[model samples]
Target: MPLAALIVITILAHSAFNGSRVTISLYALSLGASPLTVGFFISLYSALPMFLGVAAGRMIDRVGMRRPLLVSTTVLVCAVALPGLVPTLYPLYVAAACIGTSFMVFHIAVQHMVGETSTDENRRNNFGWLALGFATSNFIGPVLSGFSIDLLGHRETFLILASLAATSLFLVYRWRNQLRHTVHDKPPAAHGGAIELLRIAELRRVFICTGLLASAWDLFVFAMPIYGTSIGLSASTIGLILGSFAVATFIVRLALPWLTRHIREWTMITLTFGVALLAYTIFPFVSSVMLLAAIAFLLGLGLGATQPSVMSLMYTTAPEGRAGEAMGVRSTVLNVSHTFLPLLFGGAGSALGMGPVFWTMAGLLAVGGKIADRRRREVSAQGSG
Candidate 1:
């Protein structure tokens, strides 16, 4: 299959997985769950991934993406359907964790497959397309999820999402041959473990930046429903707010070739933090949906441009034949924040106020932007010297 076809499949499959986050959030809240409890549910999505990320990556390196991708997609199909089967809070807990873990495996494999197949000239561009797939799915997921829940109720929405995954499963099975990588015959990179990969200064810097951005991204997804509910926004309205953010990401990623040509990756990362910080700083002060969505759009423009650069940087910087491992390690770094931030922000939001939660994230973004800017300066100095 062509890269474009795979990207199309990715958008189709991921729309369900990504959009489920909001549906799950709204469903949990409709069940009388508190903010802190909702945080716990969101946290469950990252719990297993935090622990198993590296092993999944290494498994991909040792075997191949085809098997893992197939197995993981199968699991995701089951995971997405679990809630509709049971239709209870407990089932959602199981579903959230399973969905997160399974998608982690599937995502890492797809990324590794994409990176390994592309040459240096188009590697970044290809990842941009991949990232664009994610942005499109992100938009489709939330909007479709929001409307689906409003029109059909949550259980039916889950079923709809599951059908999408089942469709993806069929496609993956049909194209199974193309999924195998050339790297499988080669020996794995020599290093002690993930620790050795992290020890490299470049990877470490990207990891730190990745973590901060992940925290920002997770908080928005996990917190948006609660935040919108607190302000009495309808389910559809809240989804639109989230959808606006995704649209901004789509618009930015759509312009990546031009953006990458004009701006450096680390430089772009720094600007995203600044954009996110400004968004968070304004988030708490708004009550109207239009105002909120506008702010979300601004933040999306900032963070939307990040993934391709980050993935390209890691793939290029990591030790030979270890791109999968590097991607997995990135997941670990991301899930660490994904694992903890919902509870941290949820509790703070409950105890103090939404203002405090936004402020705290703004503070983190400030520090992250500084770190990214320093790296940008260092890169410039080295180039000019």
Candidate 2:
């Protein structure tokens, strides 16, 4: 039941996310907003969410999963609906902030729920399934949004997303009793405040890894489309290339259960970062849309493999009954990268060209991999003792 609910929520949330950048950009353009204004709005969506993630996590722990999840979903539905009703830049900015805030709450709740429900032995597989659900939704979202945008226009796309988000509320409502009883009913002995969550050494490693990985991921996803267009690719081609990445992500996540069982978490993360480094290193040299699609697929595979492992590692390290707070801190760290890296990439792209941006990302990924590898050895040594 929890898995089913999770899948529904993933589909709704991922679709909205996939569509949001393109839809908002187009909507803002229609409203006579300058490029700088559009960029500011987009950056707001990324930045605000990081700040909210920590608070949202606390809310989930305090109230239990169902209420926060429901509230977040409600806010998301309303946020999605606003673009259609207001049809202006300022209102859309407000909508984007709301969407960011709500998504942070919703994701933290879901991650906490998954952690609470699973044992350490099974947490990796559970998170892998969760990642799979997210990837599948990402796969479906862009293609659906592209066609919807073409067929119904951007205004209707927002309305459609709003409706989709509303469906998540239904799923959560149905599972409310189950989630509450499962997570909140047997509260643990009081722990220190949220700041103390930072004291977990293993969790610190997870956050460090998350921030680095997220930087690479956001840099690639945000910059690639703009770079592709600049190089004269059609919208359809860009969509196809993006879709290919999503499909590859889905394939990797499907195999993650078997993969996780056999491979150590650090080994998996190291491998992912290595592959990602290769992908970014070569990405700038590819000109053909078809070739771009192939590179994207490889990138997606590498990127997709890392996240669930990282998340599982974090959850395993979390103190009993404080999973929500731990996951929230992780989310905050991850989203902080998502918020800032794109701006840095954008600025670099403006100054040094896209080639430099790719190389810079590649360097970051390589460094991240090395750190994860080192930490893995340390952890293994400690475990053996």
Give the per-residue lDDT digits (tens) of candidate 2, residues 1-385: 4676687776777677657666887778877889988877777776776776766666676677877888888998898889888776778888888887788788888877777788778888888888888887776666666788889888898888887788878777877777744344444666665667667677777777788777777877788888898899988788888778878988999999999899889888888888888989998888988889898999888888987788788777777666777778877787778767777778889999999889988898888888888988887898899
* Model 1: lDDT to the true structure: 0.86
Residue runs of model 1 more than 4 Å from their true location after superposition: 22-40, 85-91, 150-155, 183-190, 222-240, 282-292
Q: Which candidate is the best by TM-score?
A: 2
Alpha-carbon RMSD of each model: 3.0, 2.7
Clashing pairs in 1: none
Model 1 C-alpha lDDT per residue in residues 199-303, reported as the tens digit of each score: 999999899999999889888877889899998999989989988888898999999977877777788898899999999998999998889999989988888
The 10 consecutive residues of candidate 2 with the worst lDDT sum are: 180-189
lDDT scores of the candidates, listed in order? 0.86, 0.80
C-alpha RMSD between model 2 and the true structure? 2.7
Which pairs clash in the backbone of model 2?
A: none
